[model samples]
Target: MTAVHYWRCFCGILMREVLRFVHQRERFLSALVRPLLWLFIFGAGFRQVLGVSITPPYETYILYEVYITPGLVAMIQLFNGMQSSLSMVYDREMGSMRTLLVSPLPRWYLLLCRLLAGVAVSIVQVYVFLAIAWAWGIEMPPLGYLAVLPALVVSGLMLGALGLLLSSAIKQLENFAGVMNFVIFPLFFTSTALYPLWRLRDASPLLADICALNPFTHAVELIRFALYLDFNTTALAAVAAATAVFLAAAFYGYDPARGFTRGKQTA
Candidate 1:
């Protein structure tokens, strides 16, 4: 395809996702409400007593709300990624995805467009959450807002790829909710999203080790460092690697010959 063809395809897919997001008012509300609840209700209680010790990208101890902000942002992207992929499952079942896949555009490029669209939506949600947090007095450094964009893009892509991989594997839309809960909770809770690795180490070394290995933890750390105008080579490497692996596997799983769609396509 020519450059114009590729550009138009990307825009069409992105616009479709954006419109869908706009019409789904509850989806937007729920995305905001979840993080807000954690920030306001959960954070208020914890901020008083659960002071975080000095961590990298942090010079002094910070309140629980401050410590968890990046994690909450990552949480938004994580949930959005899964939600976007859930739509992929719905579209595949409804035959819309198959229609799109039949287009002349490359399958991987089409999927990449979808992934980028999801990342864009997640970034908007994240910014809105950050705005609310700012109003509530959990402000980050001004430049940090600009600095965190790249981190968000990378983290969003990784999480979105993970969701895409899961979508390719899941056969029924009904089963997706259960699978999301199974995947989302473990990744979020087991990581440094709510608590640091040092604290986890003190409590349970095994859990700490698990957190260290979790890609979600690196996603959070990457955002955390970026939000303070810092770079985290280790976090960046871990997340980028996870993104590549997840995206590759997702492409494989969507392949018609040997992937999850094989039986259905043959029938």
Candidate 2:
């Protein structure tokens, strides 16, 4: 396809995702509610119990809510990513995916387009969450908002790619719930999302090491640092590498000759 045609296709897919999000007010509300509850209820309850020492991105002591804000942002992206994948599975069942696959555009390009669309939707949700956090007195450097944009995009893509990979492997919507539970809960709970590495280490050194190795941990760290207008080279590198690997796997899984489509047909 020509560059113009490719651009048009990308915009159309993105718009469709956006429109779907708009129509599903419950989805948006649920996404916002999950993190807000974590921030207000859980964070408030933990505020007196958990004491955060001064860290790099933070100049002084911070509240539990402030510390986990980035993680909550990542959580929004994680769920939205899986929701996008769920839509893809539904599309496949309804035969719309076959029509999309038959387009003149390369399959990988089409998949990437869908991934970007999902990321776009997630980012919007993140910003909305941030605004609400701000209203709730969660303060950060003013420029941190601008600096965190790239980190949010990178993190969103990494999580969204994982969803794509899962969707390709899952043949039916019924099976996807189990797969999502298997993937999402582990990735989120094991990461530095809820507690610092030191805290996890205090609990279990082995668990801390596993958390350190998780790409979602790096994604959260990336956002955490960016939220303070700081650079985290290691986190950035880890997330970049994970995104590449996940996207490659998703592309291969969606390839016509790779048995993904054939298996779906037989099923």
Candidate 3:
């Protein structure tokens, strides 16, 4: 099968998913707007009202906008990660996800490619946000910009696998926004993305513990640690475990016998 390894069937899967979304200009513009609104409009107003104190890996007090930049970036990936999954649910309903499933290749690679492609797309949004942040005077060290790529990819995979698992479970495009409200937002808000876990603990021990348990918290922590050129073992461990779980769940969902589907979509 080494001969086949040279072939990037998965890359083709990646491109297809990109093209599928890119063809819709409205979707593209909407995706861009969601994060900018959160960053520029909402975060700025909140920065005045909100007081984010210094936490671990942070040496001094910083603006709320700067403190939450990583989280905001994470938030974009979290939603964008799900966007394509929403598409997957729609495609499954329209009998399209099945077409990609039946290819004569390893199933895991195909899914990985899809996840990576989504991550790549998420990276694009992050850079766009970074550019906007720069224009707004939210610049960081150039190294942080360079280091954030791997974190973006890893964070994307974690969330993308999450999307895959969710697509299989929800089985419908409707109610996705509800899923975001109930699941994704809770994960983001409760995490150290907005405020550090220690600060949350000071406010409430139980809530802090819950945020500590969240994988997205770890994803944010991972990026936060990486951005500062620091290593967070807990964040790394948490992300690794979460990615494994989501990937396992996703593969199980794609099992043909399990009704995820076995054959290609019939045109």
Report the Cα RMSD per candidate.
Answer: 1.2, 1.1, 2.8
lDDT of 3 by residue, 1-267 (tens): 665562567567778867866788787677778777877888788888878777766777888888888888898889888887888788888867667776766777777777887888888878988888889888777798888888888888899899988987885667677887887878888888877777788889999999989899999988887787777888888888899999999888877677653333334
lDDT of 1 by residue, 1-267 (tens): 799999999999999999999999999999999999999999888877676889898988788999999999999999999998999999988989988899999899999999999999999999999999999999899999999999999999999999999999998898998998899999999999999899999999999999999999999999999999999999999999999999999999887677566556656
**Candidate 3 has which clashing residue pairs, if any?**
none
The residue-level lDDT of candidate 3 at 40 comes to: 84
Give the TM-score of each candidate. 0.97, 0.97, 0.91
Q: Give the per-residue lDDT digits (tens) of candidate 2, residues 129-239.
A: 999999999977899999999999999999999999988988899998898889889999999999999989998999999999999999999999999989999999999
Model 1 alpha-carbon miss at residue 86, Å:
0.6
- Candidate 1: lDDT of 101? 92
- Give the alpha-carbon lDDT of every model: 0.94, 0.93, 0.81
lDDT of 3 at 9: 72
Clash pairs, candidate 2, are: none
